[model samples]
Target chain A: MRMPVVRTIIGVLSLVSVIVTVILGLFITPPDVVQGNLARLLYVHPPVAWVAYLAYGVTSLASGLYLWKPTRSMRWDQIAASSAEVGVVFTALTLVTGSIWGRPAWGVWWTWDARLTTTAILLVLYLGYLALRRVQVSREKRAKRSAIAALIAFIDVPIVHESVNWWRTLHQGATVASIGTNSKIHGIMAWTLLLGFIAFTLVYVWMVILRYEVTVTEDAIEALNISAWTLERENEIGSLSDEIAGLLSDNKDRTGTSSSKVR
Target chain B: MISESIAVAIKDLRVERRSKVGLNQVLPFSLVVVLLFGFSLNTQSRVLTTIAPGLFWVAITFSSLYLISRTMRLERENGALDGLFLLGISSVSIFIGKLLALLLTIFVLEVIQIAAVVILFSVHFESIALICISTILATVGIGTVGLIYGSLASDDRLGESLVPLLVLPILAPIIIAATNCWSDALGNHGGLGDPWLVLLTVFAIVFLTVGVSSFGAILED
Candidate 1:
């Protein structure tokens, strides 16, 4: 359903929650015993990374649906491309916030570690998918091609993670299992982190909704242009046919008069 | 299907033979990439030796970008793609055929490149079998995946730039796994039959299957 009201509600809810998350995370939430102010990024990085993963997952799922025969549609392709673009944005943000947090915590802006490297590759991979979508092909052709690319990319992610994991001998801590659920993080800090996740996810939903609407409108306009061109051509052809018919009748009338006069 | 693929492979090889672009042009370009690497990374033989295996694969991969595009470009430019369809060759057969041709060309390029690396970088690899296996497996994976993107991007104007951007990220695992395997073979840092080999083998098989199955869809205009 194209529920404008729901989209607006989501937009407002996300904005309010994000502002609340910032207030709680920046000021209200207590600093960590160890990382201190750096821990405030805890409310930002993980949630954003989570949304990035979420976006890719949605992109892959939508691409899958598009590729499958029973569910094939350009809308799914639109969804896949839109989600991938948003995913690329969030993935970049994840890297930025991560390294911003990392420079203080890990003493470096970037590390060639597994998760970080995988996320970086993830960003590039979807960016490539976005590039493929931008190729000027017919809608169906673009959809099929990009869907295949997206699915290949989706499958490649785990393999990319695995290969990078094998390549790396170091660890990035158990940030995976511990985020948003660590017993050490409790009360306001935990609440704020949860709020951050929900807020960012809501924002992602709103963004994808708007992006999807834009693509739909674009395709509609393109279809309208094609139809208008077709109609104009048809009118031109119709007038030419009318002229041909009139000329044929005039010639016939002239021939008939000449034949009758000769007879 | 096998015979058709072989026929298609032969046609591609013939086209390359007549064109001489692979040897006369791309070979020099790749070797120059090696020379450029030596130029940029310091002229010390020690550093070049240390990075020789990776430099070898990087050069090969770089050349394959052109080779892949070139392999498809002639057929596309000449409109032989549709002609192949009319020849009763299935898309799978055509995919396999082009992949085989690309792999053969890559193998030749890799051989020459390794020789260049050995001469220029003063590198000695301990495990010949390991090098051969890793090279074969990695190229298969890369070629299979490359053809998929080659067909997609090669038929367009932005293809030359777009191929590397689209293909490289997906092939990251292959590059990583193959580089490690080669490092172990050359540097004696690891043992044989490591997980890297397994990753390479799996990458090859997976993409081959993916390439074979999806060729029909991707080949459709």
Candidate 2:
């Protein structure tokens, strides 16, 4: 009951924010003298990259938590899955938009610059992580395994960002992040980017919560099925039912005892 | 405990010796890579000489992935890994022993590879000892992390393909550091400065510790 209300609020708010940002992104932001309309990608591209990093960062933190204590709490896995899903989506978008930017600016769709190649590799690594999660049979195992992958995946992020400085590559080095702002015109465009960041962040948090709710419901169904199976077995075997129940309960406790916190 | 580590490693070696499956597979694949490079490039000595070092290192990195996966998958499939788990040997010893064996295997293949490259491309080596040290240190780093990923992937079904994806990111530092050192040595530049070597050594040690410490957790099924 509470879920539907929360869902409704999040759905409406996220839609409104998306619409607002898109409008601002399309018309309000000024075009670059160098890139013209093509430069409009900046609003979408940077925010999406930022969001992707934020999502992976969330995965890394959640993974650490899960490792510290493995728990049935849907929250930790929810955080991990939500963040990874969003990260993959935005990473895909970043790659496409980056290619678009490349075609116009560099006159090539792809270049094997260390940055571009490393980013591509990073994307492949995460995709592999996601695939591993899908193929694993059990939820507990999936979380533990993917958590390890997430921690490992993070090794690439700093490297990807630093690839330009580390090696000679065709890709350009840090622009917005470079020391001292390159932009002289920091008015409406800057404001729009800030708004875009906020909008994406709100969407991320709302989506994470929504995904958590779904996972919780699924877990409950699984739990209920296990309980029903035990009850049915008990009825079939008269007096030994209690003993079986005790065994099942003990098994549950042992499995659940190790680590259970979601946050 | 040390003997236990040897036992595990020897078990792997004996299997490989009898089967020769890993050696056969990697040898042909590497040979194909060589042929592809030969046909693709012109027969200019200057060009071949320039590209030989990079080519050799790339081949090493790529082939190591396949070899490590073969070794790891054998343990995974036979449930031997679980059997070894029951042995109660320290994880560090297992890591070191495996690292040593992997280093030796890769070094042997690399020697054959370097010979081929030298004959084909006419490149020269000024200091074999320095190059050997750099190669060993680089292999140590690669093997340490490779052991971790190999162990993790052993738990999963994907096996060999999973390793490159899991590792390429982690391998970036070592690759960059080692390649730079190798190029410096080959180019008649001064000794790979102490600082860089120290960094490589430190990185290898840290990863070896991590691989050793985490093996138990990952093996817990």
Candidate 3:
């Protein structure tokens, strides 16, 4: 019931999408009319942000599951941890690709614009969540504590989304959905970006599943190893003490015989 | 429960009074922040007038962060929060009482910080009551969420990084409103137009309700 066929299909599809996206990402999408090659960073940046949001959604689902069930089961905990890890990676990629794009587009590597600042803060929050998990001793405690943190952090996501709209800041509002905007992205660029978004999402899902499986297997292995070692130690303690006591008894019997002979 | 809430708040105040830890931590940082702004801008009065609200709020935000983090740490580190939970008082009352105490601390800090700024930047206070009320509305929102997230972040060792993440995004609306209100107050542009106060008041209510209801979940194992 491991569903090897399903995993295989997913793996193959993931690879095919990655290959197609990379091809489109590299050659097919036209460069920015204004920023030139630097705008190419958008090919990665938007998809990365998309994956970050996807990961946060996963975190929320896992959090709700944890709160509702309250089980010792590692499944929900593993999913939460893996989603956070993947989210952190995506957030980092967004920031890096954003700065790279900024270098050419904004004439600086960084800007204190609302979008950039909120995005950076989101990245930091998840990074902190991951770091916090490392310091806790018990898995249950870590997961519960992090579940609460994740919930709080999730609340901030909508706020971050609205920061640009709420505040008068340097960051421009929604790029694609803005009304009366004639930026008219070429068909090729839109298709390629959409493909890249799908591809990145597939990668994010794969990583989470793989990471969760690793955690489950690791826990199982640890439990197995612990039982095995305890069994060995129990057997050693059983036979070694008996052997020593038996030797003493045999010596005492021989001493009794010697005493009888002496008598 | 009300008595217990006061006890908790007074316990915090007594310790802070004795050590001056929270007070001292905020005053200097806020002063230096305002002074740094002065040095950077020098004599750009127009720019100063324009950005003063933001600078004032930024100073207020960072200073309140310091106070909230310190107060939460005192409870968390000593396991006082757990003790309070065991006493079977309403979490909402605990939240309100702690918020009351924290607002006092934040208000005093803001007053002193803004005083320093007013001295340095020559800010004209056309309506002190308006600034104070707007600040109270804004800080109520900030502290409500701040205490919730402050307590949330206390469990994690990443308090330093976590507090701001849990705060600034929530702080956005209040900061915007207060910034608009303050600049309007200073420019004699006629009192923040009731709409902004209405918005701040609504935001404060929402955060308070959310903070009080969800806080117990934050403390759960």
- Per-candidate local distance difference test: 0.89, 0.73, 0.76
DockQ of 1: 0.73
Candidate 1's TM-score: 0.94
Pairs that collide in candidate 1 are none
Q: Order the candidate numbers by TM-score, best to worst.
A: 1, 2, 3
| Candidate 3, CAPRI quality class derived from DockQ | incorrect
Off by over 4 Å in 3: A1-9, A28-43, A69-74, A102-114, A169-189, A217-263, B1-3, B39-50, B127-129, B155-177, B190-199
Q: Encode model 3's per-residue lDDT on A30-123: one tens digit a residue.
A: 7778767666666678888889978988987787688676554557878888898989899899899888888777899998777787787788
Residue pairs that clash (backbone atoms under 3 angstroms), model 3: none
Better of 2 and 3 by DockQ: 2
Our tally of clashes for model 3 stands at 0
Candidate 2: where are CA atoms >4 Å away?
A1-4, A70-74, A112-115, A159-164, A169-183, A210-263, B1-3, B42-45, B126-130, B156-161, B194-203
Rank all candidate structures by their lDDT, best first, as comma-separated numbers.
Answer: 1, 3, 2
lDDT tens digits, residue span B1-221, model 2: 67877776777677778888757888777766766777788677788787777777777788888878876777777687667667776666566667667766777778888788888888787666667777778788888778787877765665456778777767776776677666666776737563446556766777776677776666675
Kindly list the per-residue Cα lDDT of model 3 for residues B1-221, writing each as its tens digit. Answer: 68877876787678879989666777888888888887898858777767888899998898788888876787777688778788886777677778878988888888887877777777887867678788899989888878987876676465545777657756776787788778777877656554567667877886777787777766655
User: DockQ for each candidate?
Assistant: 0.73, 0.34, 0.21
